[model samples]
Each structure stands twice: as C-alpha cells, then as structure tokens.
Target: MSVTLARELACARSRLFGLRGVTIEQGRILLGALEACPRWRERPGIGELRIFRSAAGHEVLLVPSTGRVQIRVAYVVPPIERFDAAAGVLVELARLGRAARRAG
Candidate 1:
C-alpha cells in the first residue's frame, strides 16, 4: 500500500485502540517503521505480532493483539545516552519516513 494509505490505516487503527482504552502512539511508531522498512519478523506465539529495529537502533516490539508497543534501548554506553540518542533517531526516521511517503 502507499504510504499515505498506510498512514491513514494506522491512524484509524490507533483511534480504534483508543476507544478500547489502549493508547497507541508507540504502536503507530512501530507501524510507521514497518511501513517504511517492511523488514519485520513475525512472532506468532509470543504475542501474535512483529518485531523490528527502528532507524535509531532500538528494538520495537509490537503486539498487535494487545495494542502494546515496547521500545528497548540497550545500555551499552550509558542509560541516558543510549535511550536519548536512539529514541531521537527513531523518532526522526519515523517522521521522515512518513513525510517521504506523503510526498511520494
């Protein structure tokens, strides 16, 4: 699907989750990554969802069944540096990816 279509779907899905009392910003982030990269691996038994790395080198684990998203940043250097730098990169990439799709 086109990026614009994908974004629309993501937003709609997020709203659905919100109605069900689940927040979905993180889920949208992971969905954006999957849309931009399309390199996620499915883990059926674990959570019936997919796993992928964000552009920031953080592991984004998405549980579609539960509408739960987890961002994991390694503490190799320092806690602050790792999360801040990696999360920054991930957020920037997500934004650029979405914009690129819309522009396309």
Candidate 2:
C-alpha cells in the first residue's frame, strides 16, 4: 500500500517533469545529486517513490532505479514515518545543481 502511493506520487511528478523536458535519465542525475544530501543513504531494499518540489514549483519526482534485490533509495536511511525527508533532499540536490550552473 505504501509503495503504491509512492509510485502514484512518482508518476504525478514525472508528468510535471515532462513540461521541463526532464527524462528518466535526467531524473537519475537529479537522484544522484539528491543522494549527496547530508546524512542520506539507500541500501538494497524495497522500492520507493521519492518526491519533492523544485524552487520553481515543479515537482521533483524519483523512483528507486534499481531492482528489489538492488534497491536504490537516498543518502539518508529513510524512517518509515519520516518519508517527507526525501523531499528535502531533492530540494538540496536541485540547489546543488543550480549552484553548479551559476559557477559554470
């Protein structure tokens, strides 16, 4: 049930990404950046849907990009009750990307 909801959220966010020309591969990059957030981690576990909103109000969505046997989550070990933490990580990831853009 929880996984189902997460998937739905990911799907919704994916649609928003379409408007930005974001693709699954792009999502992977964003996800990688997100994992760099302070105190985050992902181990081989169950699948999950990572959700967030970009500063521009675009949804930053993510789904575990690995198989159940090789589950990919985030840098922070997810607390079952603290799922929202993932969103914050996404914001941080996006921020890093934007900063890099400015620097470049």
Candidate 3:
C-alpha cells in the first residue's frame, strides 16, 4: 500500500480508538470557552450552561456564547456555536487543569 493509504488507515483507526478522549477534549474546550471569557463570567447574557450527551455517545456540556456575555446552557448537540467561541471556556479549563494537577 502507498504511504498515503497507510496514513489514512491509521488516521481512521486512531479516530475510532480515540473517540472517548476526543469527546473529553471537546467538553474541555466547551468548558473553556465559558471560563476564559470574562464577559461570560459575571452576567453571562445569552449563553446557557448544561450537561448533555453528544450524538457520538460522548458526554459534553453546552455553553452558548451569544446574546449577552453569559455562558448559557442549551443541552443539545453541536453546542450551538461553541467550537468557535472565545477562550472563556478554555480559560476556565486552564484553571481546572491547574486544580486537577494540584490534586493529582
């Protein structure tokens, strides 16, 4: 097989095997989007906050960063436009990461 084909196969296998980790990463990103953005901290205008399962069978929390400057929860898939949100969620994740590291 060509190197490209082999790489593709490996990529597919990695995707299948690493789904759980991917979901956790997504969750952390979502969480970070809310935490990093100070605007979403105090009032959190339009965004909502809630935990829900993704279609991929992974658990994640949705925090919308729209409308006002709040981390609103929508309890659904795709997490609205969260993947593109600012670093609020990630900022929070950093703090959590530090806490976890300390605990560990």
Candidate 4:
C-alpha cells in the first residue's frame, strides 16, 4: 500500500476544478508532506478518506485510490487562490511531522 501510495503521490496532479492553478509539482510536494505527517487520521464515516488538520487551521482531505488520490485543501480563511494556499499548508504540515519525529 505504501508503495502504491508513493507512486500515486509521485504522479499525482492537483488542480482546483479545471483551472490550472495548482501544478503537478505542488501536488507532489503536498502529498509527500501528507505521507510524512503523523497527525493524519482516517476520517470517520469514510473507509478510504483521511484528513489532516494543521495547527494553522487548514484542513486537508485525502481520498486514496489505486489510480489517483483526490486531495482537497480547505482554508479556514479562504485565500485569493486555492492553489496559492497549498504551499503554506504543506510547509506547516512538514514542520509538524519533523517535530513529531524528533519528539518520538
């Protein structure tokens, strides 16, 4: 599963609807952060859905699939562009993951 997840993450494409705002590079980076984070928990009421909430109140939803996982990022305070907001979330999540690993 991890292998498949890794592959999917590597090739994942992120976009808000059909708008070409979020690039594949951004998606790959965000997905890697999700995989590295320890705060993620399987969301209740969904078998394959996982969610991660950053300390900054950004909620990231991930639905894993064999072909392609759908990733959605929601901001408590919406940004000008959804694509522009993912980098901040990714950085925070990655920092959290690093802290958790160090503490453990």
Query: How do the residues 1-104 of candidate 2 rate in per-residue lDDT, one tens digit apiece?
Result: 01211322232232211112344554555566545643334334324766543333334445635311111233233334224444443345557656544544
Query: Which lDDT tens digits does candidate 1 get at residues 21-97?
Result: 22355355446656566444333335365666543345555676565545455334354354354445345545644
Q: What is the lDDT for 18 in model 2? A: 19
Q: After superposition on all CA atoms, what RMSD does each candidate show versus the true structure? A: 10.6, 11.1, 14.5, 9.4
Which of 2 and 3 is the better model by lDDT? 2
The per-model lDDT (C-alpha) reads 0.44, 0.39, 0.32, 0.44
Model 3 lowest lDDT segment of ten? 1-10
Backbone clashes, candidate 2 = 5
Runs in model 2 deviating more than 4 A are 1-82
Local accuracy of candidate 3 as per-residue lDDT tens digits, 21-93: 2234444544554354343333322336544322333322343332111222222324434332213333444
Q: Which of candidates 1 and 4 is the stronger one according to TM-score?
A: 1
Q: Could you tell me the TM-score of candidate 2?
A: 0.31
Mind sharing the TM-score for model 4? Answer: 0.40
Relative to the unseen true structure, what is the Cα RMSD of model 3? 14.5
Off by over 4 Å in 3: 1-84
Q: Against the true structure, whose TM-score is highest? A: 1
Question: lDDT at 28 for candidate 1?
Answer: 55
Task: Superpose all Cα atoms of candidate 4 onto the true structure and report the RMSD in Å to 1 decimal.
Answer: 9.4
Q: Which stretches of candidate 4 lie over 4 Å from their true place?
A: 1-45, 53-57, 62-71, 75-80
